[model samples]
Target chain A: DVKVTQSSRYLVKRTGEKVFLECVQDMDHENMFWYRQDPGLGLRLIYFSYDVKMKEKGDIPEGYSVSREKKERFSLILESASTNQTSMYLCASSSTPVTNYGYTFGSGTRLTVV
Target chain B: EDQVTQSPEALRLQEGESSSLNCSYTVSGLRGLFWYRQDPGKGPEFLFTLYSAGEEKEKERLKATLTKKESFLHITAPKPEDSATYLCAVHSFSGGYNKLIFGAGTRLAVHP
Candidate 1:
C-alpha cells in the first residue's frame, strides 16, 4: 500500500503566526495536493504540484502556498494564519493524471488558529 | 459551473438496514466520479471510481452505480462498522489541469 505521511496530527497556532504542514509520499507519485476541509464547505483545494519545483494554485489559494523541493515531499505554508483558517488539512498523492487512479490520502492534520 | 452535491446531510440506520446515498454533479466534462469513506478526524479513504453511465462496482456490502448526472452508493445489510462519512467527488478540466471537486459528504451512523 502507498503511504502518505503527514508531519502533524494536531496543531494550534496564534493568529498571524506562520505555520507549515508537511507531507511525504513513499510511492514516488508525481502529483501531490493540499486541501482544506471545512464544515458545510467541504474540501477545497489549496495547492497542488505535479512535479518537483512545480506548483499550481487551486480554488482557494489566497492564504496558502506550497513548495515541492523534492519529489517525495510537499509542504503547505500558511504565511499568516488566521482564525478563519482553522480547518482540517489533507495531503494526497497520485501518479500523472488523477483520473488514472484516485489519490492516496494521508491521515490529515487538524490545525486550529486562535 | 462544475459542482458536486450529496443528498441527506446525515443518516442513522440500525444494523442490517439498507439504504442508498446519492451524488449529483454538473460539470463541463465528466472524466470520472469517485466514492470515499472517511472516519471522524481522518482523511478520506478511496472506495470506487466510475467512468461512464450505467457502470457499477461493488465491495463487501456496498455497491456504487453511476449515471450521466448522478451516482448511487447502495449499502446492503450494513453493520456498525459501516458507519462513516461517505464523500463524492468529480474530476473536470480546470486551471490547466484536471480539478477534483468534492461534496460536503453524508454522515452515516449505524447502531448495532
Candidate 2:
C-alpha cells in the first residue's frame, strides 16, 4: 500500500510567523502536491512539484512556496502566516500523470493562525 | 476553462436506502475521472477511476459509472458507516502536470 505522511496533524501559529508543512511519500512517486481545504471551497491547489528541484504554481499559490529537494519529501512554506491562511493542508503523491490512477493523500494538517 | 460540478450538496438516507451522486464536468480533453471518499478531518481516500465514457467500476456496495459529460456514483443498501463526503475530480489532458479540478463534494449521511 502507498503511504503519504504529513509531519503535523494540527498546528497553531501567530499572525506573522513562518510555518512549514512537511510531507513524505513512501511509494517513490514523481509528482507531489499541496492543497488547502476551506469550508465551502473544496480543495484548492497551492503548489506542486513534478520532480526534484521542479515546482509549479496552482490555482491559489499566493503567500505560499514549495521545496522538493528530494524525491520522497515535499515541503510547503508559508512566507508570512496570516489568519486567511489558516485551513486544513493536504499532501498527495502520484506515480505519473499518464495513468488513470488518482493520487494518494496524507491525513492532512489543520493549521490555525491567530 | 475546465470545470467540475457536483449536485445535491448533501443527502440523507435510511440505513438500507440506496441513492446516486452526480458529478458533471467540462474540459477540453478528458484524461480520467476519479471518485473519492473523505471522512471528517481526513484526506480523501481514492475509490474509483473511470477512463472512458462507457466504463464502470465497482467495489463492495459502491458502483461508479461514467458518461461523456458526467459520472455517477451509486450506493446500494448503505449503512451508517457508509456516511462520508464523496468527492469527484477530473484530470484534463490540456493542463500541465495532470492537474485535477475538483468539485465541492456531496456529503452523505446514513442513519439507522
Candidate 3:
C-alpha cells in the first residue's frame, strides 16, 4: 500500500512566525502537490513539484512556497503566518502523466494561525 | 477556461436509501475524471477514475459513470458509515501539468 505521511496533524502558530509542513511519500512518486482546503471553497492548489528541485505555482500561491530536495519528500513553507492562513493543508503525490493514477493524499495537517 | 462543478451542496438520506451525486465539467480535452470520498478531518480517498464517456466503474455499493460533459456517482442502499463529502475532479489534456481541478464537493449524510 502507498503511504503519505505528514510531519504534523495539527499545528498552532503565532502571527509573523515562519512555519514548515513536511510530507513524505513512500511510493517514490515523481509529482507532489500542496493544497489548502477551506469551507465552501473546496481544495485550492498552492504549489506543486514535478521533480527534485522543480516547482510550479498553482492557483493560490501567495504567502506560500514549497521545497523538494528529494524524490520522496516535499515541504510547504509559510514565510509569515497570519490568521487568515488558518486552514487544512493536504499533500499528495502521483506518478507522471502517462501513468496518470489519482493522487495519494496525506492524512492532512490542520494549521491554525493566531 | 477549464472548470468543474458539483451539485447538491448537501444531501440527507436514510440508511438503505439509494441516490446519485452529480459532477459537471467543461474542459478543452479530457484526460480523466476522478471521484473521491473525504471523511471529516481526513484527506480525500480515491474511489474511481473514468477515462471516457460511457465508461462505468463500481466498488461495492458505489457506482461511477461518465458522460461527455458530466459524471454521476450512484450509491445503492447506503449505510450510515457511507456519509461523507464526495468530490469530483477533472484533468485536462491540453494543460501540460496534470493538475486536477476540483469541485466544491457534495456533502452526504446518512442516518440510521
Candidate 4:
C-alpha cells in the first residue's frame, strides 16, 4: 500500500518562530502538495512541487513556503508562525494530476501557534 | 474560475437511514469529480471518482453519480461507523495545469 508519513501528528510553536512540517511518500510520486484545513473554509492549497527542487504557489501561499529536495520528501515551512496560522496541515502525493489517479494523504499534523 | 459547492453543511441520520449529498461545480472543462471521507483529526481518504456525466460507481453501501454540472454521493443504510465529513472536489484545467477546487464539505452524523 502507498504510505505518506508525516513527521509529527501534532506540533506547537510560538509566534514569530519558524516551523517545519515534514512529509515523505514511499511511492516515488512526481507530485506533492501541502494544504491547510480550516473549518468552514475547507482545504486550501498552500504550495505544491511537481519535481525535485521545483515548486508552484497555490491560492494561499502568502504565509508559507515549501521545499522539495528529493523525490520522496516534501517539506512545508512557516517563515514566521502566527496565531492565525494554527490549523491542520496535510500532505499528499500523486503520480499525476490528483483528479486522474487520486491522491494518497498523510495522517496530517495539527499545528498550534501561540 | 473553477468552483465547487457542497450543500446542507451538516446532516444527522438514524441507523439504516439513507440519504444523498450534493456537489455542484462550475469550471471551464470538467476533467474529474472526486468524493472523499474524512474522520476527525485525519486526512481525507479517497472514495470515488466520476469522469463524466451519466457515469456511476459503487462501493459497498456508497454510490456516486455525476451529471453535467453536479455529482451526488448516495449513502444507503448508513451506520454509526459511516459518520464522517464527506468532501467533494473538481479537477479542471487551469493556468496550464489541472488544479483541484474543493467544497466546504458535508458533515454527516449517524445515530444508533
By lDDT, the best candidate is 1
**What DockQ, on C-alphas, does every prediction get?**
0.76, 0.71, 0.64, 0.71
List model 2 lDDT by residue over A3-104, tens digit each.
999999999999989999999999989999999988767888899898999999988999999999999999999999999998999999999953466889
Model 3 misplacement above 4 A = A98-100, B93-95
**lDDT of candidate 2 over B1-112, digit per residue (tens):** 8899998899999999999999999988898899999999899999999989999999999999999999999999999999999999998755455788789999999999
Candidates, ranked, TM-score: 1, 4, 2, 3
- Scoring only chain A, what TM-score does candidate 4 earn? 0.97
lDDT of 1 by residue, B1-112 (tens): 8999998889999999999999999987799999999999898999999999999999999999999999999999999999999999998887578878999999999999
The model with the greater DockQ, 2 or 4, is 4
Q: Is the docking of candidate 4 incorrect, acceptable, medium or high quality?
A: medium
Please give each candidate's TM-score: 0.98, 0.97, 0.96, 0.98
List candidate 4 stretches off by more than 4 Å: none
| Worst window of 10 by summed lDDT in candidate 4 chain B | B92-101
Report lDDT per candidate. Answer: 0.93, 0.92, 0.92, 0.92
Task: Output the TM-score of candidate 4.
Answer: 0.98
Instruction: Give the candidate number with the greatest DockQ.
Output: 1
What is candidate 3's lDDT per residue for B1-112, written digit by digit as tens?
Answer: 8899999899999999999999999998888999999999899999999999999999999999999999999999999999999999998654466678899999999999
What is candidate 2's CAPRI-style docking category based on DockQ?
Answer: medium
